[model samples]
Target: MRKNSMKNMRINEEVHRELSNIIRSEIKDPRINPMTSVVAVEVAPDLKSAKAYISVLGDEKSQKDTLAGLTSAEGYIRRELAKSVNLRNTPQIRFIMDQSIEYGVNMSKMIDDVCEQDESKAKSREE
Candidate 1:
């Protein structure tokens, strides 16, 4: 498959789906929480490497635990992914913690606070 080809996109999606399933159903590591989710997947042009972005809905400790579980289960996850996708070469899986969701929420809260303050200031000025 060419770099960034349609096939690559499809492969990324497939990997993402299969990896999520594998993580959810197959792996039984205690470190991994059920709240974990696959946020995104990025595959290399050669299809030899895949990075899975995972979001853990908990504190920092739980997030670290989930990542640790994923990191240790990389071999099994890759094997399952290959079998599930029927790929000639199984891409090495890498787990990364994704915090974009939390960041967005925090940013939204800050914007709301600023807006409320601005409205109060405007009201005071009018008064």
Candidate 2:
């Protein structure tokens, strides 16, 4: 079974939401940023392990610290997942830093700048 199918996507979304809530409400690590979000979740077909991609709305230090804190609390996170979700086997949680959102934001800013420059050039040419 391919990992990108609708079923997998649904599972990923559910896991993402569950993990995000668990991290925010249950995990008491000070390193975690208040604005952290679980961007995506990738789970193995056998459900043995899961990689949780998290995005932190802060500087690099905050992102790194959040990842470190999540890594340290992996065991507890998995335990909580097992207790919350009715899965046959709870996957081991691995936290990874996700920069896709930041990249998208930067890309959008660049596009806007280019559009403004083009508009200015066109106006100059017309004048």
Candidate 3:
């Protein structure tokens, strides 16, 4: 009775794979940067709509441009996905920017800084 069953997981993975391929090789939108990639996809239970998480590796301007490009190309992307993936209904695509990778890197840098400071303090204490 659950919608988030194994079937949904397969569909989500296939959709994510197809989308990543389409965005990387097929899409010609000037707004889409080369660094843009599909991070994940979540399809609704009814399969009427799906949310795609995209990671843009660049400055803020490029990220915005890539999002704009993806938003504009939603229809075409859906059509391509439908053609590539066999499903009863093609889900509407919604592009969302994912910045988790950046956040993680920032956090790692902060942690490293703290560790370095602690090491320096230990050295000074010894001296």
TM-scores, each model vs. reference: 0.87, 0.86, 0.93
Question: Any idea how many clashes model 1 has?
Answer: 0
Shift in Å, residue 12, candidate 2: 2.9
Worst 10 residues of 3 by lDDT: 1-10
Q: How much does candidate 3 score in TM-score?
A: 0.93
Tens digit of lDDT per residue, candidate 1, span 39-89? 999888887888899998899999999899899988888778878897767
Residue 38 of model 2 has an lDDT of 91
lDDT of 2 by residue, 34-96 (tens): 999998899877678899989999999999999999999998998888887777678888888
Best by lDDT: 3
For model 2, the superposed segments whose C-alpha errors exceed 4 Å read 1-10
Evaluated against the true structure, the overall lDDT of model 2 is 0.88
Model 1 global lDDT (CA atoms, 0 to 1): 0.89
Q: Rank candidates, lDDT, best first.
A: 3, 1, 2
Estimate the TM-score for candidate 1.
0.87
Backbone clash pairs for candidate 2 read: none
lDDT tens digits, residues 1-127, model 3? 1568999999999999999999999999988999888889999878899999999989999999999999998989999999999999999998999999889988999999999999999999999
Evaluated at residue 116, the lDDT of candidate 3 is: 100
Report RMSD (Å) for each prediction in the order shown: 1.8, 2.0, 1.2
Which is better, 2 or 3, measured by TM-score? Answer: 3
Q: Which regions of candidate 3 fall more than 4 Å away from where they truly are?
A: none
